[model samples]
Target: MATLEIRDLHVSIDTDQGAKEILRGVDLTINEGEIHAIMGPNGSGKSTLAYTIAGHPRYTVDSGSITLDGEDVLAMSVDERAKAGLFLAMQYPVEIPGVTVSNFLRTAKTALDGEAPPLRAWVKDLKSSMEALRMDRGFAERNVNEGFSGGEKKRHEIVQLELLKPKFAVLDETDSGLDVDALKIVSEGVNRVKESTGLGVLLITHYTRILRYIKPDFVHVFVEGRIAEQGGAELADRLENEGYDRFVTSTPVA
Candidate 1:
């Protein structure tokens, strides 16, 4: 089974004033078919952890190690990481003005698999996946996220997740800006992918609404760049009612 391991990870970023530490010392392990939900208040370094794992240049790893199935993830470049079965769905999906959605997805699939999929099979799969996500057929012809709505962009991200079938996915605030109906549809898509592929997930969010559909196996409360508490799905229920007030007050200012 595939496993992503993070050990005492410390990350920092350069700023106008000075260097600022983000992830203090995060240690977690996600195996295939497991879902880990990370819930925290704003500015608690949640997105920093996601970006660091994805090998973002802006976030510097100060210490510790990240390994994927015994391979050193920290040593791999961003694309190399993706090729190794790591995927990150960004909070704000970027627009590729000239590339059509179909072309971009196929190119990515070809790169990851090291062989171009058969044209007929690829087209059929693309059409089916889009229809399942309730995306119109014309979306395949349009430029990637060029004129798409927020919900459309999010659904497109799920389309990539389903088609790419990565070993692990780090979703950074995917539920943000989505309405109730859109949220359920996106969450259902994620669930379907996980069930089919045994895909591991590290879901980051502030509210518990998405949890109603995704149903995390483990719930981790992130406070001031560190995980303060962890438990089973029941933890999410407590968080939904209690919020992160207790954790916020306990964390020291930087």
Candidate 2:
């Protein structure tokens, strides 16, 4: 069991005007077996929060700390953080033309566990997970996300999550660009993985459609690089009804 803590996190991007801060003193905490949904408008720094937690190189941590299970994550490299039980499913999953999904998963699993699984068992688990996601067995042989549909790409990320079994995972817009059926499949996959792994989830999304399927323990409204409001699942419904204009107008974008 692990807890992910982000305290007073301030992120900045390099620009002509020097470092311009994006995340302003953001504070969030997620413990094992909890799902935290962060919703916000465009350019509100929701993605920045996700990337910072994942230790993306472009996002400069002006001030703050990201701690997972008592270790300072900001000091670790991206690969180190992944080894330390943190996973980030990017909003735009890249396409690696030469890398097969099977090979990629094998490398990641071996790196995390310090040993590779038996060939038979690894193939069985991968096949079963792909079947659960409604994906074809051929997907394992295909290059990662190369020529895949939007839904397929998103499902691929879920496949990675199910296989990796990281202690803490940040899903950035996993629900975006997915249709109704794809959304349900992905949501179900997420739920299944969480149920089995007891992983803490920080889900970054712009709409409530996904929330209808996976009930979040907490829903937070992020505006102007900070969390403006947070509450139970009902808060998601409230935002759906009222929209985000009031909250967006209140917070200056900077």
Question: What's the lDDT for all of these models?
Answer: 0.94, 0.92
lDDT tens digits by residue: candidate 1, 1-254: 99999999999999898988888899999999999999988888899999999999999999999999999999999999999999999999999999999999999999999999999999999999998889999999999999999999999999999999999999999999999999998999999999999999999998999999999999999989899999998999998899888888644323
Error of model 1, residue 8, in angstroms: 0.2
CA deviation > 4 Å runs, candidate 1: 250-254
User: Candidate 1, TM-score vs. the true structure?
Assistant: 0.97
lDDT of 2 by residue, 1-254 (tens): 68999999999999897888899899999999999999988889999889988888889998989999889999999889999999999999999999999999999999999999889999999999999999999999999999999999999899999998999889999998999999999999999989999989999998999999889999999999999999999999999999788887654454
Worst 10 residues of 2 by lDDT: 245-254
User: What lDDT does model 2 reach?
Assistant: 0.92
* Candidate 1, pairs of clashing residues: none
Model 1 residue 54 CA deviation in Å: 0.6
> How close to the true structure is residue 8 of candidate 2, measured as C-alpha lDDT?
92
Best by lDDT: 1
Listed per candidate, the RMSD to the true structure in angstroms reads 1.3, 1.3
Model 2: lDDT of residue 160: 91
